[model samples]
Target: MKQLVILAGGKGTRLKDRLGDLPKPMIPIAGKPLLQHQIELAGAHGFGEVLLFVHHRADLIQEHFGQGSRFALPIRYITEKEPLGTAGAVLAGFDQLADRFVVMYGDTMMNVDLTRLWSAHEQSGADATLFLHPNNHPLDSDLVETNAEGWVTTFHNRPHAAGQFFRNLVNAGLYVIEKCALEPWSHDRKLMDFGKDLFPALLNRNAKLFGYNSPEFIKDIGTPDRYDWVCAQYEAGIVQRSSLATPQRVVFLDRDGTLVKEVSAQGLHRIEDLELLPGVSAAVHELNQTGLRAVMITNQPVVAKGFCTEEELQQIHNKLETLLGREHAFLDRIYYCPHHPEKGFPGERPELKIECKCRKPEPGMVLEAQRDLNIDLANSWFIGDTTTDVQTARNAGVKSILVRTGHGGADRKHDVAPDFVFESLPEAVQFIAARSTETSGE
Candidate 1:
C-alpha cells in the first residue's frame, strides 16, 4: 500500500471561533472529526497507512486516532518544532516517505479517487502531479495555466487585485510527489511552500508538472461560513460523488456559427477556411478551467450534399483543435450530423438525404451525449447563434443562451426565447461562470 501524508500543522487562526484550542482537522463535520473522514476516504482508495505532520495541538490528534487502529489503518505522527511551510514539513519526514507518496492538506474536505490519481501519476512519469479543479472563487485562489496535454505551463498564486483575468482552474491542495523532486531543496533553511515557492522553482527548471483536473468535491473550510457550506454539502451527499461515478455539468456548443466564424455561405470545404472567431479560444479555455465539458454539437450537411467528404470534415475539426491548442484551449469531443432532410443537389447521397434524429431542432445529439458523458441536464447550458440551436436545447431539457455573433440577434426571428443573450462566446462564458457562483453560494 502506498503511503499518504496529511499536512495538519497549520494554526488555522481563521477558524479559531469554532476550533478554539483544537485544530481545523479536529473540527466535527456530520458527527465525526474531519480528519477521520479523510482517513477513511484514503483507506477506501488503497492508501493503507497515513503519516500526519502535526504541530499545533498534536496531542489532541494523536489521542483521538491513537495509531489509527480504530480507523483500520496504522497512523503515525511527526511533530514539527518550528513552522515549516508546506513543502518543508513534507521534506522533514523524508526518510519515512516512499519514492512516490500522496500529500494532501488536512483542512480539505474532498473525496477523490486516490487510486485513479496515483495511477495517473505512475503512467505519466512526471516529477509531480497536482490535483487541480475549477473553483467558484478563482479571484482569491491560486490559478494554474496548462496546455492541451494538461501539463502545467505556469503557476500563479493569488494575484493582485488589479491583475489580469485568468482561467478558473485552481490548485485543490492535493498532490502526488516523488521524493526526488524535493531532494534538491531539502537542505534549505528558509520557508518552502508548494504553491508560492516549490512549484514555481520546478517550473523555472522546466520540470514536468502535470495536473489532474477532476470535478470531485474539494473545498477548504478556512472561514466559518465555508465550514457551514461544506457541512451542508456533506449532508446532501455532494462530497460523496466521485468524479468517475457522478454525473457532470456540460456546455453544449454549436460548431460553425457559435464556436468559429460561419463559412457555410461561402462554402468552406478546406482547412484554411476554418478560422476561430475572436475570443473563442479564450472562451473555450475558460470553460475548460471551469471543468465544464465543451462538446461541439453541429449539423454538417456538407457531407450529405457531397460538398465535402467525411475525411475532409475530420480534417476541418483537426484544424480547429490545432488552432485552439495554440491558445491552450481544447474541446472534449465533437458530434456532427452529416445528414440533410432535403437534398435536391446533383451529387447528394440518397441514403443520407432522409431526416435524422441527430440533426439540430431534434434532441438526438444531446441525448446521445448525455448517455456517453453522464451529463446533468438541469445544470447544463447550450450556447448557439440560431433558433435551431435554442430549439435543440429546449428539446433536450437544458437551458439555452443565444449569442449575437454568428446568426444571432436580428437574423434570428423566432418565437423560442433563450434563457439569456450575449454578444459572443466570451460574454456567454462570463454569464455561465457568474451564474455558477451564485447558485453554489460560494
Candidate 2:
C-alpha cells in the first residue's frame, strides 16, 4: 500500500469569507471539503493511506475524517506546532514519512493519476520527482526548467528577469519525494520552502531531481476568484476530464503561420523573426478554458537544412510559449519533425537528410501525439494554414480545419480538401467550440 502526505496548514486568511471558522482545506468544492476531493482522487489512483500535516485548525480536519475508515483508507496526522513553510513542515515529519511518499498541497484542486506518477518516479529513480505543468500566468509564477531528459536544470522564481524568455513550465505544487533526500536537512528547523529555498539548494548540490511535465488539471483555489473559478470548473466536469487518466480531445495546431507568423519555406531561423498572428493568443486561451488540450504539431526541417540547430529551434518555441503565456494561453505539448528527405544541401547535416515518419502529410507526429497524450482522434481537430496539414489530418482520420493564414491553400502540393475552412485559428476554434457544445447536448 502506498502513502500520501498532504500539507493542510493554510490559515485561509485570503479566503476568509468562504472559510468562516473552518480551515482552508475545509472549503467546499462540489458539496465536499477540498481535502475530501484530494483524498478521493488519491484513493482512486492507488494511494492506500494518507498522512496529513496540519497546523492551523487541526481539530476540524481530525474531527471530519478520523481514522479515514469512511474514505476507504487509513489516515494519520502529524500536527506541527508552528507555521513552518512547505519544506519545513515536511522535513519536520521526516521520520514519519515512508521511504518514498507523494506530497500534495491541501489548497489545490488537482486530478492527477497517482499511479502513473508513481510509475514515472520508479522508472526514473530520481531522488525527487516534481510534478510540473504549464500555466497561463508564468510571468508571475515560479518557473522550473528541465533538460532534454526531463531532469531539473534551473528554478526561476517570481519577479522574473526582464527580456528573458523561459519555458512556461511551472511547479504545480505536487511532488514525489524520497525521504533519504530530506535526511540531511531534517535537523534544520528553519522555515524553508520548496520552490523558493529547498529545491534550488538541492540543485546546487547536484541532486538527482526529475520533473514530470504534464498537461493535467491542477490549480490552487486560494483566492476568492480562483475558488469560484475552480468550483465552476468542477461543476462543468473540466476538472476530472482534464486529467491524464482519461482520453483527451486535443486541438493539434500547426506552428508556423498557425501559432506564429511564417517568414519563409525553410522556416524562420532567428528567434527575433518570430511574431504571433492576431487573435492567436485569445483563441488558444479559449481552447484551454473550454477543456480542449491544445497541442502543436509542426514540420520544421530547418535542423536538416542547416539553417538552425535543434537548440535554436527550442529557443524559438520557448519565445512562442512566453508570448502565449502573456496572453494566458499554453500548449499541452509541441511535436515537430526536423528530418528532411532531400539530400545534398550545402552545410546540411547528412545524418538528418533522411525520410522520417514524423514529417507533415505523414501520420507519424499525430500518431505519436495520440499515444503520448491518450488523444481521441475521432473527436479531435487539426487546424493548420496549408494543404499538407489538411492532408495530414485526413491521413490521421481526424477532422481538419484549414485556416487562410500563411499559404491559405495556395500550395497545390496536396490535393486533399479540409472538412472545414476558416479565416483564422480564432474562427476555427469558435466553430469547433460550437460543435463541441452541440455534441455535448446529444
Candidate 3:
C-alpha cells in the first residue's frame, strides 16, 4: 500500500459564506468533514499512511485526526509557513514523501477506484499517470492530450487560445506520481502547479507521462453553485454509484451519420466538414443528466483508404467534441477502428487494408469498451443509422436502435433489423431514457 498525500490548504474564497471560521476541507458534508470522507475512501483502497499538507487553520485539521488511530491509518502533517502552489507544497515537503505516492485535492469530491489507477501506473513504467476525463466546461479547464496508446503527448494550460482546437480531456485534479520524477526540480522550486507548471516542465525532459482516462464523478466544490450541486448529487446517491467498482450503463453511439452528418461516403475526413445534426447536442446533454455513460464507438475506414490521415481524423473528432461541449454535453470515450477490410484504392495504405476484428459488424470494438469501462452489456444499448450497426448490437448481445438519417438501412449491407426504429438520434435517445425510467420505477 502506497502513501496518500492531500493538499488540504484551500482558503475557500468563493465559499466564504460556507466557511466562516473553518478551513475549506473542514466544511461539513452529511454531518462530517469532507477530508474525512477522502481519507476513509483511501483507507478502503488499502492506503496505510496519510500525509496531509495543510496551511489554513492547521489547528482544526490537526485536532480532528491526530495520529489517525480511529481511522486505522497513521496520519502525518506538515504545516507550511507560506502558501505554496499545489506542486510547490509537495516539493517543499520532498523529504517526507514516499518513493511513489498518490496526490489528491481537498476541494474536489471523488470516489475513484485508486487501485485501478495504481495498477496502470506500475504497468506503464511512466514517471506519472494523470487522471483524465471529459467535462462539460472544458474551454476554461486545463487539458491534456494523449496518443492512441494513452501516453500523454502535451499539456494545454488554462486561458486556452480563442479558436485553437483541443481534445475534451480535462485534468480531473487527481494523479499518481514518482518521487524521482520530482527530484530534478526539488531544489529550484518556486510557486508551481502540477498541471500548469510541473507536469509540462517534465514533458520537456522527455519523461513518460500516462493519461488514465475515466468517466467517474469528480467535481471541485470551489464555487457556491458547484458546492450546492455536489451536495445535492451526494444526497441523490450519485456519488456512491459512480465508483469504478460498479458496472456502468452505457449508450454506445455510432459517429458518422448518427451524431455528425454523413457528409460523404468516404467519411467526413476534413475538420471543417463536420457538423452536428439538429437536436443532437441537447439530446446527448439530456442523456448526460440521466447518469448513463455516453460512449462513441465508430468505424472509420478513411485512414485505410488514405482518404484522411489519423491527425486529420483527430481534428474532426475534436470539432465534434467542441460542438457538443458548447451545449454542455460531452462523451465518456471515443473509440474508432481505422482499418478497412477491402483494399486497392488510389492512395490506400496497404498496412491498414487487412481484415481486423475492431471493424463494426464485428464485436471487437464493443467488447473492448465493455472491458475498459466495466460496461453492463446486458443493460446497454447501441444506436446508429445502418443495418451494419444493427448487426453489431445483435453480435454484442445488446439492444439496438436505427435512426433514419444517413444510410438509414438503405445501404442494405446486411439483412439485420434493428430492435427499434426512429427518425433521428433525439427520438432514439428519448426512447432509451423513457425505458430506463420505467425500469427503475422512477
Candidate 4:
C-alpha cells in the first residue's frame, strides 16, 4: 500500500524536435505514452495510489488517463500554473502525499524493484533513501560517494570532482522520503530543486540521507538520442514490461525477405512475385494457435521511389492475406514505411526523404504497431534478415532473430548484431516457439 508521486511537469525541451507539440511524458514508446508505462510499472510494483505532478499540457495527461482505473490503480493529478522546480512541485503537492512515499522522475525509465528499496529505507531508518547506480559517464552526472554501510558521505556535480571521490555512484532519480524532511520548505516558495537546494540543506543539517545501490536497467530519456535508445531497449526485450495473466508476447516479421523470396528490386514490382517462404504459413499458424500475434513491419521505399503506388501496395498485401488464408495463418497487422532518403531518385520528393521518425533503423513503425495492436515490446521478438531490420529492433527495444532466408544471413556479417540467428524463417520460428513454451512452463 505504498503511495507514489511522479514528477511529470517538465517542458521536455530536449525531445521537442522529435515530439513536436506533445509533452515529454506523452511521447509514445512501443505504442503507449511513456507516462503510462511508468504508471503501469508502479502499479505492478504494488503502489496503490499515485499522484501525477503535471504542468505543461496537463490536460493531455488528464484526458488520456482520467482516473487511472483502467490500469488498476487510483490516480490523481496536481496541476501547476507556473513551472515548479522538482522540490517545489513536491512541496506544493505535499497535502496529497502520505507520511512516507516514493518520488520518481516521469521522463526516466527503470525496472527498479521498489519493494527492495522500501525495505532498505526502513532498515536504515534514514530520513531519505536515494536510489543510486554506477556512473559509467561520471563527467555528466551528480556523483555521490557512499561509505561501506551505504551512507552518502560526499556529493559532487562536476567533472573536475571525479578524481576526488573514491567511488562512482550517481543518483538514479528515485527516492523514498519521509514527510518530515520536507518541512523546511514553504509550499509557496518559487524556486527549489532537490539536487540543487534541498539535498544540500539536508546535508548541512547532518540529516541521515543514505544511498541504495541497485544497478538495474535505468535510463533518462532527456534527449532525442537517449529517447531513441530507450525505444531500442524496449524493442530488444531488455526492459521488462508490466503484464497480467500469462504475460503475452508477440512475434514481429519482416515481409520482404523472410516471409517471401527476395524479389530482385525489379521483380518485387508486382503481386505475382510475392510468395510466402517455406513453412512460413504453418509457423504463423502455430503462433496464432498459441494466441501470439504475427505482425509485419516493413520498409517499402518502392512507393516513395515511384516504382509502385499505394494501391499496388494494398494489392500486394491482399495477395499475402489470400495466401495466408489458404494455409490458415493470418497477419494481425502490417506496418510499412513508404519514405525513402531525399536522394533516392530524380522524382523522389525531398519532403518524403527528410528524416522521418517512422523509418527502419528507427522504431517508429514497430512502435506504432505496438500502440495500435497492444503488443508487448519487452516480451516480443522481431525476426528479420537485414541490418536495417536489426537496427530497427534494437532501437525499438525488442529481441531480434536474423533468419538466413532474407537478408538475415548477409546481415550476420554486418555491423549490427542480432540476439539469435537462424538459417531460415521456419528455423527462427521454431526456436522462438520452443522458447515461448519453455518460458510458459508447458
Best-performing candidate as measured by lDDT: 2
RMSD of each: 8.9, 1.2, 1.5, 19.5
Q: Count the backbone clashes (under 3 Å) in each candidate.
A: 0, 0, 0, 14
**Which segments of candidate 3 are over 4 A away from where they belong?**
438-442
Clashes of 3: 0
Work out the TM-score per prediction: 0.66, 0.98, 0.96, 0.55
Steric clash count of candidate 1: 0
Off by over 4 Å in 2: none
Residue 307's lDDT within candidate 2 is 96
Predicted structure 2: lDDT: 0.91
Q: After superposition, how far is residue 303 of candidate 3 from its true place, in Å?
A: 0.9
Evaluate all candidate structures by whole-model CA lDDT and list the values in order: 0.82, 0.91, 0.90, 0.77
Which candidate, 1 or 2, would have the higher TM-score against the true structure? 2
Greater-TM-score candidate between 3 and 4: 3
Ten contiguous residues minimizing lDDT sum, candidate 1: 159-168
Any runs in candidate 1 off by more than 4 Å, and if so which?
Answer: 161-163, 249-442
Candidate 3 clashes between residue pairs 3 or more apart in a chain or in different chains: none
lDDT of 4 by residue, 249-316 (tens): 77989888888888785437587777788898788777654545677888888777777877787768
